[model samples]
Target chain A: MTSHPHPAPTEAGALPGSLLIRNLRKEYRAGQPVLKDISLAVEGRGITAIIGPSGTGKSTLIRCINRLVDPTSGEIWFGGSDLARLRGRSLRMARRRIGMVFQEYNLVERLSVIENVLCGRLGYVPAWRAFLRRFPDSDVERAFALLDAVGLGADFATRRADQLSGGQRQRVGIARAVMQDPALVLADEPTSSLDPKTSVEIMELMAALSAGGGTPIVINIHNVDLARRFAQRVIGMSRGEVVFDGPPDALEDRHLTDIYGGEGWLS
Target chain B: MSEAALSGPSRRWVRFTPVERGARALVYVLTAVAVIWSLRTIEIIPEFLYDAPEQTADLFVRMWPFDWAFYPKAVHAALIETLHTATLGTLLALVLAIPFSFLAARNFTRSGPLNWIAQFVFVSSRSVNSLIWALLFVAIFGPGPLAGTLAIAFRSIGFVGKLFGEALEEAQQGPIEALTAAGAPRSMILVKGYWPQVEPAFWSVALLRWDINIRESAVLGLVGAGGIGVALDAALNNLYWDQVGLILAVIFAVVIATEFVTSFIRSRIL
Candidate 1:
């Protein structure tokens, strides 16, 4: 398991809250690696944006954190516990502390806005209560508050998710993620599907929420400008390897060209 | 360029060989000959051409002079009984189908052998017609609405279970993944992720089964299982054509009413 070589670090930083990845390797097929021996540390409460081209295993990397896509071999140490080794009840408990936002919104289309938002608390609540739509009063209040924070008012709660526009649905998605009251939030291309203005707004909202909650966020973004604007630290990936990791001021054109492989799209 | 070069080559028309054309013609001729011969052999002469319109008109006239008082006593009790049978059977089937559907759905149960067993049970239950099931139940349980109800219920389980399983399998994988990641038990995922997605489909299928069961229950009584079918059988046996006409009219009315009610319920749910 420990035979694979660790890839060279693109940058060095002290990541908070102690999420240490040591020699993480994932391969879908035998000897055909999707993720090579990737080692990194995520520390403290701040946004870390992972920027990479498509099919470079950015989404796969984030999903592996939550075990949505199980890693072939890795050690994810968070808060003195190895998340990879946990299973069943213990795994769920760990996941409740981790929130995730998707690019497509992935809201339950048939369920009402409030119900979909309430799903974030599914990890905390009893199964019977969640099944019956009998969410706790505090959770309900918090859900409504989160909705308001995301710019959707109380009236929109009763409307089905399918009835909402893309922006509104994504707002609900973000609200649901926040509803988990997670210690860590992972956003995989959160603004990829949104327009320019909406993307900025969403990024701002996520940055503000993470800041206010003191939660560490790891966001996978394709937009370098948005990432530079929002993220405290930007990690660049190419060919499943991190090529650059630093502050916006420290990043130059050469590094961008190296990461994305061309100067044509940079303009 | 020359006109011939611009126009390109003239394609050869591929025509069928003489033998092939003859064979095609022979097939048509044979089909026509067989159809005509079979029709004649079955004595399918159109007797309507020789029918007396006056006699049909007289029969209709007789049916119209209905014992209006008979409608209140005869239809009311039988209609209620039919409704009861249908409701009971549907409820029972819904109860029995839950576990069976879970077993049958490949998404729910990955075990090939278990899924096959569930499918076998569903197939066996559905393979026998409702009427035959009713007859068998009548023999076992003795003649009553119980036999008819059981028959309808048993058949409905197979129908509803198969449909429910399909609906269950097609539910969104996203939420299920989310729940699993949250460290939720399999049961929790089922309750949270599976139930919400499949509920409307389940209700829609159950209502459809109810509609079908109502009609089946009505006819099951013909085999002594108890309902309007028993009355229909009696009317036909006695050669009371007036009563038969009356019963048919009532059955038609009941069917239409049930259809309307079920449609209304279905619209509300979906």
Candidate 2:
């Protein structure tokens, strides 16, 4: 059964949660590909920020891993299965292990904050249990703890999600993602709508919390400064292709200009 | 404070284009000519305006005050029956509409053929008038409260179903996406995500439909389906103007009472 050269069993790629994307492509409309043969790998730990200018396919690349935006052609290997080819039940199960946080903090407005946190458990809980809202005691306790960890007090449990400010909502968003105990996390422009201070605070919280459990997070970030600050590894994309992939220290002005294009804004 | 010095407009600017002026003149002339022609075609008699006041006065003289004695004999029971018919009918429609609406809502019901069938059912139910439905049901069930109840339910299905489908369609996609990413099954998505979003609309639509059903049921008895209209029809047939007046007054009171009650419920629930 062993066909390829062995890279020692202890190699990072042998780990169950390792994410490897190969030749991924997405064409929202025919003849106009948004993700063009992008390939990368993460060893399934720590934060890796994908930075690019607007409309440079950063969000699309993140979404494709979750199968939220279907990849036109490629292989997304994670958790011992090809994510791109999954359908229905298989797709949902895979998505469960890959948590996502949206830019807008898409909490169900009518739901209480605790319920929104419990939403991350829907994949594990039975349909009837979810409908009855009879979450397991452990999941409920975990959800409460997660709320506290995200800086919302346990008293905020019963409050409606819409009652929170932008920063608080993003905290809940992170809490919701981590509540899944996910193998990997994807955050699409997680701080684009946030103020400068709040943006850094969220990035810090995301890095600390996600790294605590050794869950790898792939965030689509527009702010290059925050990416440089929090990300251990950085990916720079331009015109649907990865132009730079290296550690944060190696990301130079030349790369920024190459990724973002002739930036007078860099001044 | 300087009213005399202020003016409406200056003559230097041309307002309406010549083409617009011609089009407006054509519209005005055509509308006036059409109204006059329609009056002639319908054989309108201006003389009725002269005699209308006397006829109305004489009719009022005949109707005079309420027929207090007749209220107990026929009006009260019929009014109660009308209320029962509407309540039961609206409940039945709601039960049927919930599943039917899921089928008709395009975003939920992905199959083209199934959606077509659901839409056809809604259209067919809505196309027929409640009175016509009453007439059909009366022919089948033999002129009773059952006919009136069935008539009201069948007629309301389209209205409630269409509104419900629209409400589901217009639900915020973001929460639903969140649920989907959480691995919620389709039914859980409906109960937790979609239902909460459309709950206010559902309540409002149901109450409004119930209010409409009440009015429809009252007059359904004209086609031999039992209601307040039956008592009024009988009195009219017998040339008893006072009893007819009494029944009309009861229907009016009942309608106004229900309007107040439904509006109160809507306010509280929504």
Candidate 3:
């Protein structure tokens, strides 16, 4: 295990999961680009939040990094491979190293929480083993540990996923993502479906867990206050373009107005 | 009511337009004409119609004393054979239909040709009745329980496969997306994501088809495919109304018993 207890190197050093995206463009329809040209680099550690109005391509940008929503044209360099170009087995290998959390918890509702968390190890284990639910003992132990780390105790492990409330389900979601032992974790509006108090709690839990594991997070978030509070670095976006990229302190009301458009709601 | 009174131009609301009313009246007239035409065309002999009640009474009188002694000699073995045929056929249908169901489900297999082929198989299998299937199988397998079992199985594939495929198609996309993002292989996604969602529906559909297959296979023996229907056919040919009445009663009791058993199992399992 290369995971260190200390914080990752701050400088643009060779941290294992440092992502460098170059001129990424995506178009779902011919000549109608959803993401016009995006370029940014994320550090290997710390929470980097991308804030934007709905439909401004925050999801497109985050999904592009893992090649989930494939970029029409661009290069995403991470761990010595272009993620946009990888296909089949190689693509799966790259994806297994990056964990993602969704706005909806997205748990297999019929499965037990422990089994859902063990799904993270699917890419690493053989298909037959997974089919039989005969995961390695160490993987099972780690899954339990991750559930505990995500604020769910061992008692919750055997319960069906659908039995949990929204907050509890997201906790299971986070545990599942963390169970992958990812180098980078991407969260696409991870707290939108949550109530305000639970959203803050989830962000806090995510911040604590990822920081301790030295795993970097690139989260697409709509709640600007939550973003500023938890994100070390914030990238503000408008019309599929990044308008501001800096420390959270540098994100003034004017920048929020520019990113979200209009000062009507700022009051 | 106040708003309408204030408006003063109270309009009426009609359910159907003039054209729609005309169309409905035309449908009624056509249906009446069709009934009259069929009644006029049907060639019913007046003498047979007049004696129908007496003939029915005479038939019942002949069948008054059922051949209960036949149960130990023949009906019991035939009844057991019928059940085995139904059970084995249902199991076989489940085994064969599962793969076709996967192929037919649009979400599971994305290829158009595969879906079309699976649907084609289902349609052809369902179009032919089980008795016809028994006839075809009896010719191939030469008069036995094997023919009866195969007949039931072949007839059930379409019903079981179509429903199972629809169940697989209805699985939520959210869980599937999560598994895919986790870098799970396609096979793993099917096993972990889709299978859990569809398991209950699979069993429910299998049980339902099995229940229907029991009724179908009971009559397959009339085609020389082997079941209680063989005894029924022999009694009818030999003009033994009492034995025929006994077989019918036994079949009725067994059908009711199976219905209870399947419903109980379904409730418990689901």
Candidate 4:
């Protein structure tokens, strides 16, 4: 497994820590914690894969950063502001800067692919424009470009989302994410629903997008090999806590055992 | 070993108490009595059976003998007015229901008190029948198509709002989550995620309501609210069965035709 090296530091106006989660804790019910005290800083660019066993809080942690599931206690410092305290318009403004891809494509199934891709601009575009399906020219161009980059051609734009295959839908999903011109991209088990070959392709597209656009990516993945293959840094999680955080080369069998527990499954 | 095991169970059965036996007998007796009672109560008596056939046959005979002459006048304007009233009412209802339905949806309105208020408004609007609403409107607006239109529109809001709200609730949570995560405002999320999913169901419901309103509008005219049913009612009162027959025939044909058209439209949409 090989990893992409981190991008060189740039002087452009970039958020210092694309995401800074400090002492994050979440509990769905009292005394039953989904995410324990977690502290991590995601770099400004490149993919950082979060690998964890099933039932671990990998999904919960990613969701918390986006505040899809609000944190019980924590400060998520993005750019210069703490997202946990933000509400209403302020929260939406922060969210607009972040893009998310999901395990399920999550495209509005009845909507055309172009419309689904254009949904990324819903935050920036006026409600009337969204309701009318009248996306601005620039957003359309960017969506088309992103679609082309993801290997979908012009004709697929008018097709209903449900008509597409899994890989095709995920490509649209990625396009929608990038359409946001997001500062940070969060993918939660994006490729888990795809076949191995398609998973690799999806991961490659995500990696390239992360590196090319210099968008910081925090991905929750179940496959260790895929994580090591694409990510610059691997954060191993078990029972809602980070067990190991280092470069993929430094991640060894012991760390895997510790993260997953027991030797029988490792083979 | 097998004989001894079986014998022990048989001996236990023999030890069964008189109370168990009495309970079993009671169950059988009660079931028998209940069955006999129901049969006696439900059995159609000779008098009812003899009375219904003659009445049904007389009605059929009286309705027949053909009403060809009245068809021309009935089809010329009355049918058209019914369709027009229905179309106006349904369209108006659809426009009014959209905002109210969004407010009424529990998922969208998280505040319990607000949801209760919305629900109260929706339930109250729907509680009154269209005919009753038409009567009330006629009292306010006077005898005209306007009252009929308002009545149909008001009644339709209850139905469309409740159904559309439910459809909105059942919309895929995935798109909503994605929109929220992307920081889209509540209004944006509704347009992008919620409306798209519910649009088809909304349209279908509206179309169905339109068809029903057409039928209702026909009857509203009998109450002085403008439609063909007034003429039909007068014809019936004057014992002009031939004209009544003609009006009934026109209504039946119109309804069937509208249903076919609506079904075709719904199929294309789906």
The numbered model that scores best in TM-score is 3
- Measured by TM-score, how close is model 4 to the native structure? 0.87
Task: Judge the docking of candidate 2 as incorrect, acceptable, medium or high.
Answer: medium
lDDT of 4 at B190: 84
State TM-scores per candidate. Answer: 0.85, 0.92, 0.93, 0.87
**TM-score winner, 1 or 3:** 3
Question: Model 4, range A1-267, lDDT digits (tens) per residue?
Answer: 023132233336756537778889999999999889899988788899999898899999999888898999877888667777778898889888889999998998988998889889988998888877787999899888888999999999999999999999999999998888889999999999999999999999998998788888999998899999999999999999999999999999999999999989877
Candidate 4 residue B110 Cα shift, in angstroms, is 1.4
True contacts kept of 3: 0.64
Model 1's alpha-carbon lDDT is 0.83
- By lDDT, the better pick of 3 and 4 is 3
lDDT of 2 by residue, A71-186 (tens): 99988888877788889999988988888898998888889999999988888888888888899999999999999998899999999998999999999988998888888889
In order, the first chain's TM-score in every candidate is 0.92, 0.94, 0.94, 0.94
Docking class of 1: acceptable
- How high is the CA lDDT of each candidate model? 0.83, 0.88, 0.91, 0.86
RMSD, model 4, all Cα superposed? 6.5
User: Model 2: runs farther than 4 Å from truth?
Assistant: A1-13, B1-21, B45-49, B111-113
| Candidate 4 segments whose C-alpha is farther than 4 A from its true place | A1-17, B1-52, B66-68, B71-75
Model 3 agreement with the true structure over B145-206: per-residue lDDT tens digits: 99999999999999999999999999998888888888888899989999999999999998
Ranking 2 against 3 by TM-score, winner: 3
The segments of candidate 1 whose C-alpha lies over 4 angstroms from its true place after superposition are: A1-17, B1-75, B182-185
List iRMS for all predictions: 1.9, 1.1, 0.8, 0.8
- Report clash pairs, candidate 3: none
